[model samples]
Target: MKKKNDHGVFAAVRMAAASHRLLTVGTVLCVAASVAVSLLPPLLLARVIDRLTAGLPLSFLAVLLYFGSLALEGVLTSAQESLLVLFGQRMTHALRSEMSRKLSRLPAGTLAEQNPGEVAARFSGDVDTVEALFTSGIISMAADACRIVSIMGVIAVKNTGLALILLLVLPLFAVFTRYVQKRMLAAQLDNRRAVAAVSGQVPETLHNIRTIRALGLEDYMERRYDRCIGDSYAAMERTNFYDAVYSPVVLLLNAVVVGIVMLLSASGNAQLLTLFGMSVGTSVAVINYISRIFAPIESLGMEIQTIQSAMAGVRRIDAFLDQPERTIPPARREAARGDVEFAHVTFGYGERHVLKDFSMTVKQGEQVTLVGRTGAGKSTVFKLLLGLYQPEAGTVTIGGVKVGDITDRERRTCIGCVEQHFSRVPGTVLEQITLGDPQITGEMAKDAAALAGIDAAIRALPEGYDTVCTEGIFSQGEWQLLSIARAAAADPAVLLLDEITANLDAETRPACWRLCAVPPRAARCSLSPIASMRILAAERSRSGAGNNI
Candidate 1:
């Protein structure tokens, strides 16, 4: 499980080990007490049988001792349950906190490689499995082990021969559990994959909800979801079958072992009144012990299942975190001002090159425009400038500092980007602009929103600045304006505007064009656009086909 420092499974194990101490001590005590009390019933029954057969008058002291043991057992069982709950809650709290911390430390693109549904399931489904690890794996097994040993001591110390036969069967139990796990592992992984496939589909339906509504694709999405669900069911059924087969076989084996031992005791002329040095009551106690041991062995199967699920989650999280982000030369620097230059920079995600040795230079304070075909890597230029993507060959620099060299904090603070598909955030319209920037007070937000021709539209909301608008209700034009408002709030040194004017109304185009074209602070950038008369006249012009936009 150990890979690099970044892929440390020891970190996760240490997480489990160090979470809480009181819960562990409490659970151990709880298990010990419960196990001790449970063994009492068999002894009490043996006492009543022995006493009655002897024709001795029933004594009040005997009745009192039996009833008192029963009452103690009842009380201890309740305490055990309470402590188990505490153990589960504490373990979950630690797990969730660690998971959240790990998530925060990971860089962007971590979730890009994973399905959305699978990510969501980590908190819900993955944590549930972890809970089982603490409950069944820890507490249940501990109590079962205590019962097995204590009862074995009773039987072996009293009658060595009968106890020997029972003790021999434990290896068979271990072998059987191992075999069941081997059979179930592959089916478990298949179930997890089917779950992730469903999660990946949810965002597609949400993002393209309008297209689905217009073309009546709701039924199509439902069918797709149904198919994923069916696959998941098939995988679960396989896992269930493994369990169903395992349980019956184990039970049959257990019955055979105990039946042969009982037959030998009855026919071999061995004394039933005592086992080794212990009384008949203790021999019966050993029989009770065997029954308790089988339950943990059975329960261990489920714990193994939960463990397999948790291990799979750990592997996925490890894979996602271990993947190296795009790297740059070791000596990187801070962005001073956006004196941008792209020198024959070539880049690609994988296989397909998006930017083919792209070259462009914008002098300090110069506002240039990139106009190109729909898929002509125009936006790719801005992604490079913002330090989101690195070039494969050559360099992209800002104010003499290589874009690759810029520290993440400085890079984000220096550049502002407004994507074409910006989503309207929940809360008031002001939130869509300010995004909780302490310096971007209410008045500055309105000024920026007004400049983008969205002030009136924002004012029409019931709470105006405070009205909550969640999900996908904003028109494309409204989203464009909101993007502009957000860009201005950052007060960035370099601005990136991607098709912000495409969805605007005809009359609003000119104002929107000027708002983007005007320089912010000493910020100088190459303005990329799909189409705009202002950008075309100011940034690009050709006698033949003109700019591609």
Candidate 2:
């Protein structure tokens, strides 16, 4: 789908600023006040020097004004920093929360198509870049701009000729700025991609650590990671090269202007020394102001580069937010009767159809086992049943009502699934079992674990249900058991198990079968449990063990 290119970096800034306008406005005011106060010290010092040269007594009040301005500038600077830091934190929190909400609403298919590393990079690195713009870069740039303007006004009033010479250099600086700004964002985006590759590699390597070690592939993995780092380093080097060139050029131009003023003053030329009363005191102040004025231009050049990085991040975030969301129209919330059917279903990934004219029916309360080869669409059947995917040419019905009649929320409440691969969630055993469901109690979790024949494994850990169980802590077979236990904890009317015992060893096979013995709830019939397997026996179906396909 075509997306609107509008609302990139500025929209993100507006979103953050909207939440804390008072704080944002206060920070800008402090920056402005600090810049205004800082110009005083240089002006006051010039006055004192002029009086000294005139053979007059130094005014104590002038010195007092200079010192007092310094103090006031320091206070304003501190307040600006403090306010920006607070705003940065608040903005980081709000943006991250918004990204999470957007991710949650996206379609399952869309999420599956995204790379984990890329998503993580956007979430952390991109979000941080935007935060930097808010917390330090934007405010500091504003202050530098104000300082430059105030110093420029003072310089122009003091001597128009000198101001004119200095002003000529600005157009060159503007051209240089435009050139650098154009290249920066593209380079930063490439750098972000390189960094994301690195981010994805680490977790992927960790997940396959056992395989890597078993095959002695450490050097191979290390070389791959080195490639990612090298690309990122090269991207950053290009950006820094622009920064290297811009700062020195501005400094060199400022120095040249200062040299002309000093030489003209020494030559005692009336045109150079007398205009706007450009005496020794005024010359000194002008030289100082040149540095002050040029300093902002240089810093601003760098800040503009940072702003580009933030803009790239905003574009990424906006693209993600624009992706299609899973939408379930309002539908009946009636409970499913546990009778499931797939009528003439046709589905596939892209053009390669996996299921063609498929039909199936399982009576309410009947435990059915679907047996098929790896490519025979058994898993696809379960996906269709669970509403994870829609068939192109058929209807799936649950409880005698079409799946279209059920809301996503209602479907989730009625069905639970245990798939072949288990996600390694970081949490205690109980937390893993309940999966953050507030309605499930510890006792209920333990009961679910017991039904899945995983309760003994849970109790073996030092903290039992409270024991932390992340990746690498559990064997593949044990992890599958935990997945089943989690599905059981949901206590849904229909339970779908797709090759749940595929990873189990011979020793764990018997224990896995006990998972089907979970006591049916009051509204659940005996036929609600459906298991897909790679092999099945006719005797098993006839013995009421499970209906085999």
Query: What lDDT does the true structure give each of the candidates?
Result: 0.66, 0.75
TM-score of each: 0.83, 0.87
* Residue ranges of candidate 2 with Cα displaced over 4 Å: 1-15, 214-216, 272-277, 328-331, 400-409, 470-475, 510-549
Please provide, for model 1 over 46-132, each residue's C-alpha lDDT reduced to its tens digit, 9 standing for 90 to 100: 686667767767788778878988899898888887777777767766666756666665544444555667777766666666666
Model 2, range 1-549, lDDT digits (tens) per residue?
324543334555577788789987887778778888878877887888899999999888988987888888789878988988888887878778877877887766677777899999889999899888876578788888878888888988987877777678788788989899888777898898899999999999998999999999999999999999999999999888877888888889888888876676676666656653476677777877888888888888888888888878877877776777677657664566556788899999889999999888976555566665567787788777777777899899886777656766666556777788887677798998887777778987888787666789888888888988766667888888888778767566567777666677678865445434333231122122322221221233344332222
Go through the candidates in order and give the clash count of each.
8, 3
Cα lDDT of candidate 2 equals: 0.75
Winning candidate number (TM-score): 2
**Which candidate achieves the best lDDT against the true structure?**
2
